[model samples]
Target chain A: MPGEDIVLRTEALQKSFGSLEVARSVSIELPRGARHALIGPNGAGKTTLINLITGQIRPDSGKIFLEGRDVTQMDVAGRVRHGVTRTFQINELFPNLTPLEAVTLAVCEREDLAGQFWRPLTAQKAAIDEAFDILTQLQLADVATRPTRTLSYGQKRLMEIALALATRPKVLLLDEPAAGVPKDESAMLFSVIAALPADMSVLFIEHDMSLVFKFSSQIVVLVGGGVLLQAEPDVVRRDPRVREVYLGQAGYV
Target chain B: MTTVSQAATDPHSWLRGQSRWSYFEIAFWVIALLPFYFFPTYLTLASQIAITALFAISVDLVLGYAGIITLGHAMFFGLGAYAAGLITKAGWGEPLTGLVFAGAFAALIGFLTSFIIVRVRHLALIMITLGLGFLTLELANAMSWLTGGADGLRGVDVWPIFGWFEFDLWGYTAYSYSLIVLFLGVVAARRIVHSAFGLSLRGVRENLTRMPAIGSPYRFHLQKIYTISAALAGVAGALLTQTTETVSLETLSFQRSADIVVMLILGGTGRLYGGIIGAIIFMVARDQLSGMNPQYWYFWIGLLLMAVILVMPNGILGGLSRLAGRRS
Candidate 1:
């Protein structure tokens, strides 16, 4: 893998809650167009790491680089404007808006029309078309007019992806995209993920090993708030240390 | 599938397909026109209703759509009233010019305050707004020479509408002027709420966290809306001052702010016509009830309010919209 093509890089990231250090000297590099997976046991600070990367919470120390531009000091909106976007572990959608409306809002924001108060949103022909395209691609076209709150868990998850994609992000962080979906539904979700543009890098955190094994090109195993291993999926599956720490109990190796 | 394509092809399809102007709006206009004929004697009260409705709509813009809780909105209202009144006192009593001065002055103040206001949320926002309202009230009271202190600014002589229609005791000119302004204000507000900016505001209200992730600067949008809302409120105040031919410290009072909020809630929040409907019902009801028994009228008003809150928490228009099976 060419490391020089890094799209997202974290250097010695550190964070603590009171006395408990959740992230300690954590450094990660995700190359351009990489399909990356972050897997760790509960309390291994996976969420804390994501928050640090997204600027939801500031890390005590270290820097975050997006395409070699230091975004460590950027606020959430600033980072998003720099083309970094993420989906929540739980669906965070505008519940009252239909899928079409929600996606249209995202599209409008992306098109820099977020402040256009004079023209009606429906008048934005290109935005509406693009929003519908995104919804259709995510397999949410059937329920485009239905309010998001009324959607199924699987549909909501897809809508979350659609919202994130609407921003046309350079790097998309998906926090447990299949978290609440059934096994059969997750297959559909993963397929949609797999169909994403080849140039867009994706970093996801998932507990489901099958999905993880199938989706990620590279896997980073986190243990005790530190990187235990980083390798290709096949290599990670066979590693004895990885087996001893994680895969051994599941007997996946 | 065809609907999507059609929506894309015809730009006005989305605008026309949606029920923007329903019977409620039509009924509001009809009722607004009624005071001109049947109750010509009460044109003064009608003008008051129009002014109050405009103020309530301003409150609704922020509180309803943006989910910002404010308790000191009268700061802008009073500021506009004083600005307009002071201009007239200075012998520059051009009604149109005074209106512009009031709106711009109020908008300037709103823009300055929003830097602080948009930084906080929920209870802090409410308290800060309340504090601002009281602060302006005190400032107005202390400047007795300028604001006439607690006694109120009096002897404000407004120019006739278009330099022709003098404001008579019958309040015909004032009522018509206020109604026209109120109509324009509602049209502008309707345009705003239907626009992309308004959708982003709703998005922010629904999920603050998700908004920034989607590239919306939370404080920026809030501040923008706050300024727009304040400008509208100021216009309302100017209308009040112009019609009443007076500016008073009560315009900036916490009571004024609170009452407008209550009226907005009673009418419904978020909906374009909520404030107008709320203002009409509230002012009309108050006029009737207070006329019956001035001292104990509030007791009846309180009882009715409690009943409305318990039965339809969304307010009169919201409940009515629900009955009509339309989204409030």
Candidate 2:
């Protein structure tokens, strides 16, 4: 913890959509190089919390900080510029673009490649190179040139993560990374997460108990839009409140 | 220094090193010089081709690049022609000034009209554009004093290009003038389509949500594409007025709007050359079929369109491109 910078920390975060309170006074911290997990019931506001962190939706009240810098008011893209990248719950890959093209475009956005339009897509060697590297790391090299629409659902999901990785963020947020993916492909994702850059911090929301236990070093539980418990994966799994709120006494917790 | 990452590690590195412009430039030159050596027997037909080709290309920019489906694009072209005709008849005299004014005027109308149009999508957008075109043409018909009513404007003098070329009513000057303007329009459209701004438009067309997720304001880019497309449509209109030396309220008719859509669809939507081919084939079919039987030509045209739609939903070039893609 001495060298860790607490890459992302949220203080008393509160969010409500109209009359629905989805996140309530949630306080959370992600260490400099920590792999943190947010676990909760189906409607525990985990997605809302991730959305607030990435500025996809504004918090009704509370603050989000990245690398000790306040990013409470930044828009989604602005947060991306500040090194926060997020993978959506549903795959958002460009359906017609190849995985390589998708990653290349993400690199273009990261490097401000919009102005290089007249220069030809081929001229941005460095950005393209970096994109390729990111795609390769995500195990997308095999389907690099295949249009995303042609890829299997698992590959499309992987491509979505590759796109987020292409931004080269200091803090990465994954929303249900293992949801809807094949078991084999889901395991591959864990391997990819384990292989990310040492300094990068990842905060993930997942419902898959196996994925959560395998990848998370720390876990925070949210029940009914509020923090239910925060502890190591094993401890949180055993917590009675987590059982009562998420497991409901005798079910999948 | 660029490090060569292994293909096993990253297969797309090859794409990172290739340029998309060199290929585009080569294709552009081939198309631009094509008409010069292949002028048909009648010069009037050639001139008509040039004008219609420019119009088609203009429509393609909005349809293909911006992903805007407009059936009323002729509104800008028709406005440009009528504005130029009226201003020149009022002693503006110079074709260049008339043309510039025409584009400016049409662009202004386009800007105002688009604010109401761009907020809608698909069928609603098409209907709004169609309605806007109809209303403009109707208004033009109602104001006969300036627009010559349903009779059409006549005797509008267009001075020669650069004061040296007198526009002859015959094929000679009209053909050459249209050829030059069409070439210029193609060059400009190509530059715009290949430009960085255009790339952003492509991005928006590909995925609207992804654009803002990457920090782009999609609405601003959409507006820019709309304005530029209108300006292109305006130039095509101005060229038509210059060649014909007359403007009819019919220029803005719903039929003309429908014709543009047919032309784009027949050629291809997003592919640049689709417009040119669509226009040429459409006009030639109209001319030949009408010669055979003027009264029944619409029947053949309708049948031909139906066939094209049923056989190739992407139009000719679009279908061919997909075929080539599959083979590749």
Best by lDDT: 1
Candidate 1 per-residue lDDT, tens place, A74-171, comes to 99888888888899998789998778778888888878897888897767778877888998788787777766899888999998899999999989
Write model 2 residue lDDT over A1-253, tens digit each, in one string.
Answer: 5235688889999988888889889989887677888888888888888888888888888899887889999888888878888888987668876677677777777777754434656556676678777776777776777667999888877876787877778888888877798788788877888888878888888888888888988898887788878889889878877777754643422
- For model 2, residues B76-107, the per-residue Cα lDDT tens digits are 98988888888888887687778789888988
Candidate DockQ scores, in order: 0.57, 0.34
Q: Is the docking of candidate 1 incorrect, acceptable, medium or high quality?
A: medium
- The residue ranges of model 2 lying beyond 4 angstroms of the native Cα positions read A2-20, A55-75, A115-118, A245-253, B1-41, B90-101, B108-118, B131-135, B138-149, B326-328
**What lDDT would each prediction earn against the true structure?**
0.87, 0.78
* Candidate 2 Cα lDDT to native: 0.78
Q: Pick the candidate with the highest DockQ.
A: 1
Deviation of model 1 at A206, angstroms: 0.7
